[model samples]
Target: MKTWLTRCLLGGLLVTSPALAQDDDAPYAYPEDEPARDEQQEAEEDAYERRRRQVDETDDFRRVSEEEGEEGDFKELAGVDDPNIGFAVELIGGALLLDSSEGNFAKTVAGLGLRATWEYGRTFNLEPLRENLWADLRWTYGSYSDGTDFIRGDTGVHYFTVAPAYELKLGKTSLGIFGQLGGGIGYQTTSITIDAAETKVNGIKPVFQYGVGLRGRPRLSNKLSLSFRVEAMGFRRGYLNDIFLGGSIGTAF
Candidate 1:
């Protein structure tokens, strides 16, 4: 977020008393030590004022300027630019293993995930671990099967979630082991069918998600760039708690 600073200039300095300014030629007029400013000087001062008005500061105290070099840096960091910081339109698929929670008996669900990232490696320009830092935005949806249809007739454990994640690789290689930590809102649903009647219950609750795996990105062309990760993850919320073993395919720009 941006916080604009209001400029409060002293108008009295520019708008002198009419009696003094108009009576300059009269007796006991004010003595001017500095020469009258030329048109060029006035224009320069006006330009300076305009430039001052163009500066805006961000929440992290980063200064944003009208200059393209600096402006682009800030915009990309804010994830406002079209070609975000990293991967875009990445499609991921994985498997979720449901836990032994009461009132709901479901396990081994197939899930799909979408991940987009705003990497900070360029914005911050730090060395060593720079390549591993990014702002992760992910959404996951799944179609899972209910473990046993005999006890609860037919049961379904399904969910869709959105989370902000943090990921970092262990080493600086195209194929490196990485770990991710994320938490966000998950709208989980539990469906049960007894005889011929079907009933579902769902709620929006906080999710606990984490994953670790090996990923590879060989640095291909922007349009053809591809990356993948195979991970063992744990997903949990108010409705269900389970571990996930999955892999993902991502395209980077």
Candidate 2:
């Protein structure tokens, strides 16, 4: 019985010795070098924080870029306008003499005059006058017959005239009444044949004219317009002592 008790006591002591050894090593089982899980968790959190900061910075840059683009577009739209348009016209016509200091000359005397005109001007207010004022220059040619009692009988006189004038607007459509005043220099040439005798005479004179007339215009295209004007004027000179009636139709460009 004593020996068996002693063996039992020895086995108990062995078991207790092993339990004491395990308790002493428990504090050193988890070392600072073996903290792999904690290190991994901290590293993951740091990476996540870095990624979040990058996302925030990218969004801030995107917003700033959008604002700058809008500002650039507004600055490109602020300077200068367009231009105004204009044109000129030329009218030509036949002329008739209306007065005579020489008697019974209408049935016996023959006369004709040609007129050339140039007009140019532009709109002032554009709403009030598309074409405001115009300047006109004219050339006239005329021929007439003489009576039997004159020194050079069975003969005639020819006249040439150059006139400069101006016109003001009374209305639109080129079909309206207008008043004009102008003066110019003239030249006269005479030819006579009596009893098989021929003679020639020439002279220079100054001329004055006043007229009121109507104009009618028809449009052909955007760059071209056709116009007509009827005008009358008085002429007094060594060659002609009469009033003249005339009409003209021409193109404008």
Candidate 3:
């Protein structure tokens, strides 16, 4: 019995001893070493995440830069449109009426004139009242001659005016009618032979002007247009006033 007990105890001890030997043969790690290993793994993961974010940011920046570059290229390829501005030359024929304290000094004086204009294409569309508004700067020079029993005189007038103009369409066609009203200053010189004596008078005066006209482009071209205008102008100073009626032929550009 003693031998059998001893054999059983020895068999159990051998089995347990192999497990202890296996545990000893396996690698041993300290508590501090475990924390270091975990920290190294975490650091590697954080580095990988940072590199991934950097790559994503770089891709996004490249995409935005490419889009902006394409937009700039398109804008460069497309050109801006032209604004409306033009030049005009005109020839005018008119009648001048002069009045002084002596009633009507000259009943009618025939005149010829020339005009140069810079048409500015900006308008204040006072809607319902008017549209197709236009403005212009005009320089005009005119000469008149009168030969009557009462008065014999030659007069020259020069004016620089700012005209606010408006247009009304006659129809759907290219032909349109226009009107202009202007007020500014002018210079006038009169040489008269009264009682066979030559007298010269020269001065500056305030001028008011108005016009109604037809304007249209020719059938062959739109770059050029023909214009016909009937204009009336008046000058006033003290008790002296001069009135003129005129017609004009002009080219528009």
Q: On a 0 to 100 scale, what is the lDDT of residue 71 in model 3? A: 48
- Overall local distance difference test of candidate 3: 0.64
Q: Which 10-residue span in candidate 3 carries the lowest summed lDDT? A: 74-83
Residues 1-253, candidate 3, lDDT per residue (tens digit)? 9999999999988888443344576577877767545888889999999999999999986675456444464222111122223566777777767554456465566656666655443222223222255565655665767788667988777776777776776666646677878877778799998777889999887777676666553333445666556656665534566676777787765
Q: Rate the local accuracy (lDDT) of all candidates.
A: 0.61, 0.56, 0.64
Candidate 2: deviation at residue 141, Å?
Answer: 2.6
Candidate 2 C-alpha lDDT tens digits along 208-251: 66677776556777667776677776666654565557676666
In model 1, the clashing pairs are: none
Model 1: residue 199 alpha-carbon error in angstroms: 2.7
RMSD of 1: 24.1
Candidate 1 lDDT tens digits, 83-141: 42455556778776777666555566677777776555546544443456654577777
Q: Ten-residue segment with the worst summed lDDT in candidate 1?
A: 1-10
Best by lDDT: 3
| Each candidate: RMSD | 24.1, 20.3, 17.8
TM-score for candidate 1, residues paired by index:
0.54
